[model samples]
Target: MLSQLQKKLLNDFQQDFPLSPAPYADIAKTLGVSEQEVLSALQELKQLDFISRIGPVFPPNSLGNSMLVAMSVPEEQLQTVAEIINQFQEVNHNYHRENRFNLWFVLIGNNQNHLHAVISEIESETGFPAMRLPMIANYFINLGFELDWND
Candidate 1:
């Protein structure tokens, strides 16, 4: 069960989380709790699987160059390929989808050259040529949820 503090955190802090060096301390001050309390509660929430993670959701192409890559990976090798692809810092999300191309992922890098290099590395490492599907546009659904704690 989520405490009221956790509920407020889920609802209110989805976006606009502190960008300061001491971000947790900033959150604590705003939430009227000690920094440690905020940290502990967040840790507990993670432990309980209430939240997958707490971090910034960068806008596409805003922070750096990125691409949506698809690969025709054999089903038996999907797990291995995903592990290798995920080893790169550039790869953030890798998913298995049903299609001729089973494996898909997103890679981000400091620049366009770096992004292409990462893709090349992934293709070399997997021995499967990947199709580059760079984003021409982005669409997002606001994901914040409000917990009705009164009930």
Candidate 2:
């Protein structure tokens, strides 16, 4: 569970990032703490694996292209197949989903053709057909939810 202070820090950071040379120092000033303390707290959070990364989250279509892919990998070879898929720099996120498809991943590429090529490569390498689901339309929803630390 995160302390109130940590939660407040995350909330503030999410809403606003300091637009200055020393961003951390600016954050410390806004949060009423020393710069060193802010840095230490961030490092501690990262060490605890609560925070995977602290940076910009880009718009998916801002780049050339992005697609969601699902593969029906055999249970025995799931790990090996996942590793192979993850090797591509174009592959951003991958997960084991509970479905007949089993393995799901996101691939972002320089263009639609490049994205298709990556999918083909994965299929050839893993010997599993990848089902590509390119986003034709999107409905943005405010999908924010608070975690109940006391639970």
**Best model per TM-score:** 2
- Candidate 1 lands at a TM-score of 0.69
Give one clash count per candidate, in the order shown: 0, 0
Best by lDDT: 1
lDDT of 2: 0.84
lDDT of 2 by residue, 61-142 (tens): 8756999999988899999999999999999999999889999999988899999998998999989999999998778643
Model 1 per-residue lDDT at 38 = 87
Q: Which stretches of candidate 1 lie over 4 Å from their true place?
A: 16-40, 52-56, 141-151
State every prediction's TM-score relative to the real structure.
Answer: 0.69, 0.82
Prediction 2 TM-score vs. true: 0.82
Candidate 2 Cα deviation (angstroms), residue 10: 2.1
Pairs that clash in candidate 2: none
Clash pairs detected, candidate 1: none
Model 1: per-residue Cα lDDT over 1-151, one tens digit each: 7877888777788877888999999988989999998888899989999888988776678888888999998899999999999999889899999999999898888888888988998889989999999987778766666656776
